[model samples]
Target: MFQKVLIWFLLSAFFLTAWPVSAYLPSDPLYSEQSYLAYINIPQAWDIAQGAGVTVAILDSGVDINHPDLKFNIWKNSKEISGDGLDNDDNGYIDDTSGWDFVDSDNDPSPVASPEYSQLSISHGTALAGLIGSVANNGLGLAGIAFNSKIMPLRILQSDGEGLVETLVEAINYAVKNGADIINLSLVGFEYNVALENAVRQANQSGVLIVAAAGNAESDQSAKDLNIEPAYPACYGNNSGDNLVVAVSSLAVSGQKSAFSNYGADCIDLSALGEDISSLAYYNPAQGLNNYYSYNWYGTSFSTAIVSGVAALAKSKNLSLDASDLTILLKSGAENIDALNPDFKGKLGTGRIDALKVLNSSLPATGKLIKLNQSSAVYYLDSEKIRHLFPNQNIFFSWYNGTWKDQTVEIVSQEKFDSFKIGQNVIIRPGTKLVKFQNSGRLYAVSFNGLLHNADSLTLTELYGDYDSRVVTIQNSFESDYTRGEKLSGLTYPDGSLIQYDNSDKIWYLEAGQKRELTDDSLVLNGFRSEYIIKNVNSDFYYNIGRPIKNLESNIFTYFLTK
Candidate 1:
């Protein structure tokens, strides 16, 4: 009798093996250990929306697209004919059937595994992808929050988890152009980058939501005050009501602020369970790449993925919801945990996210992309009931693929179009296409607020990692129509590109947008392999480079390692 009771308890209680009546309960072996799923109320949320018909762009270290739990949900570029060695989609990237790898500038976006690097750093993107959209209830490793959502793995960070702002900017544009409903940036940097800021702003304007980590605290420090020391992408629109970047911070299992989570009332827009999280594992040095599970991972990076998954749920429920609509719904549905963390009260954004609450809430009915009386003018009806016009065909095509007559755009009466107040005119989508004056020799990249930044040959190659094959030569009279921003001068090497002098033993880290020589030991410490470095470059390039950064002993090169 005792043995039977013990067997029954083991099977029915902990693992829930005996009962399969509950449709929500997953049979994955590791499902019981994924405590954060319950902490964020994902099981209940799943009943409403399983994240169908939504695409999430994971802009981090590349994901393991072949992972059994992830393979089915990996997004495919239907427009691009594979292995053709041509830009079939004409969207800058070639043969990006699954996703683009900005790190190596190739078609394969899978993480580059090396025996030299840490498994955690290399598997970062795969883990985040699993958290967002791994196959659910398949008796696999574990269920993802948005199991039915497709994942577009845009590899921005290298295998070591280090990446540059320029790469991030280009990736953001790619996500927006490729129809990513939500872009999950499970990465962070200490510096402010204008190109990255403009990229985020432009993506938000294009009806895509961006979710960024609020950065973890340094090794020797407590949680830093973001108000005093800001982190990029997350703090892009701080204190601005129009800010659409959903800056997510970290919370522990106890409902308290994770000691390492960067926080401030100004920057943090949401918080989620960052401690003791579980997800799929990719890098296994001993056994090689295999479908596996990992637990106890903690960071605002995972927290950001959590919120992004919830946002995916929201997007799946209401196909027309834009960035602003999702942000408002998330905030309104959050469960305030300030009472638990008295010291960090009001610093944790609206509060810990309640996925069920976010899903249950209704979005404003005014959201849509529409045209008037079969007229060529296209406008986006925003949450505030404002109609923002797409100034020209260039701007319209930048936001959408195919022609303007797609089913996504609603044909409304002129009176309905005029019902909403006119807001700002839509700007050309960034990083999708290049523009230039018809008679001018120079080429310019479009950014937020219609700002054009002049790009030279080196800027095109180093910053965008490609040449100008898709330049749109506009009429010279249109020059006055755009706001001119800064020019991309070749003062610094593209951020994160490796360089060495013609015959010098020294290697420089250009991630700071300037030349900073890496210590000989850093090569081994950070897993700087030979193939990744651009060797034998002329020494003359370093003539205008900035001095090496100070306090190298404390700074970790990557965010995943720091966390």
Candidate 2:
């Protein structure tokens, strides 16, 4: 027997509306009407992060891959070449350059156009995609919650908004194997299947977060108690005891649970805007509408998508965040809405989500400074997720500018603070200042990853014009701590040195014992600073330099220098 899947809420017909435009606001006409943006403090959250370098897999009907607002944000598979008719990546799928369409077992994941389903019903995934990651500030369409995140579309549901649990299991596994940081399941069913639960458990074990919709009430029937009639994957989280999934209910503009949203504190883990929401519309050729905007769409599906977008933002802010960390931070940062809805008190898990609060509750990313609440000790989390403490204020200041109270140091809870294992004490930042022993007057420059390079008198003048003020004295007992590298007598500079010659306008990256010129201008525009670049370098320094690197587009170099 086929289990009939429910789309979960009421949707209004496609319509056009206008709003007055102003400076500093999105030029998209619908942006003015999206009051939920301010309700969730999305602007404040964007101040911290715009969800870059994160991927959210949408397992829904299908997404319009060519939609103007979503095309640029679609996740691209770098390993597989398109139209090759072969599995280049050798991951069992052929020519899935963007994402797989499990419903049709094809490469294109766009919604299936059929006469069996209404246009409004088939447009489900595209609307959710818009809510999650439409291009922001592009003056074309409404902005998404995590505007910079990539959307990985995995088509599991069909045009009529119904699909098999077996297909969903395959999509979940595919999402995990393809590097999805978060999985969004906006469809709901009442049947409990073991295969689906196992897929969710496997995804959770792989550090991928799952966000699912709490089933909605029928028009003739009242909202059901999830504790008695629990939904499948949403209720699985309640039973897992580890918050393996984020089961979301719907909230109206009044901050109360939507009349159609399923309730019961046991299943619903969060709430978000689900009424009068607007997003991108599917292009239905049968209707000859050729439209691209939908207004007044209400559903637990959209609410789940909203939460998924915020989760993406949280993951982007701290790349080290696991599924458990995300669930904890989301719950801890939520604003309790029990006061607003007394009858539904405790029924709405953790009340409504606040994007800014969620980000504030998260730990800082690797290579940043962090401290535990109520403690003054600061630690630097490295790329390996190891925390290294600074022995003294002198040592701490050498690696950071300004003061500890600045945004450079993030305050985290005791649980988050203890997650990283303790490593060796933090060494001084490379290429910033020269160091000298207490007994020996000889000065040495710190290179990449703590290698000490001898800076002789002539080398000192060439590297730093004012060498006296840049030298930092260290205790004789600490002399053995540093690893001594090659002297500055060679034509090559230290590993972390930034050099620019008087004759060229090129900026060179010196790292990993090689010099590669950055070919992509956007990398420099993203975070590379000009102040750190050493200008008017001696011409002799360029003779033995490594060959220029072509098409260098990765942000690793920029992140290394900026951090």
Among these predictions, the greatest lDDT belongs to 2
Every model's TM-score:
0.63, 0.65
lDDT of 1 by residue, 221-245 (tens): 7777889898777888864455658
State the lDDT of candidate 2 residue by residue for 1-563, as single tens digits.
54655576665656553333532456665677667788899989999998999999999888888888789999999999999799998999999999999989999898887668667767889889998898877767688999999999988888887888878899999998988999999888898888888888778756688999987887788887888898878888563344668899899988899998997888888799888888887765555647777788888888899899999999999888877668877777788999998988888889899999999984433355567757788876665667877755655665444454443554554655677888877666566567888899888888766689887888788666666766777777666668998787645666656677778877776766666675656324433445556677777665345756554233333222112
RMSD of each: 22.6, 17.4
Q: Which residue runs does candidate 1 get wrong by more than 4 Å?
A: 1-25, 283-291, 364-563
- The TM-score, computed over Cα atoms with residue i paired to residue i, of candidate 1 is 0.63
**Clashes found in each candidate (C-alpha, N, C closer than 3 A):** 0, 0
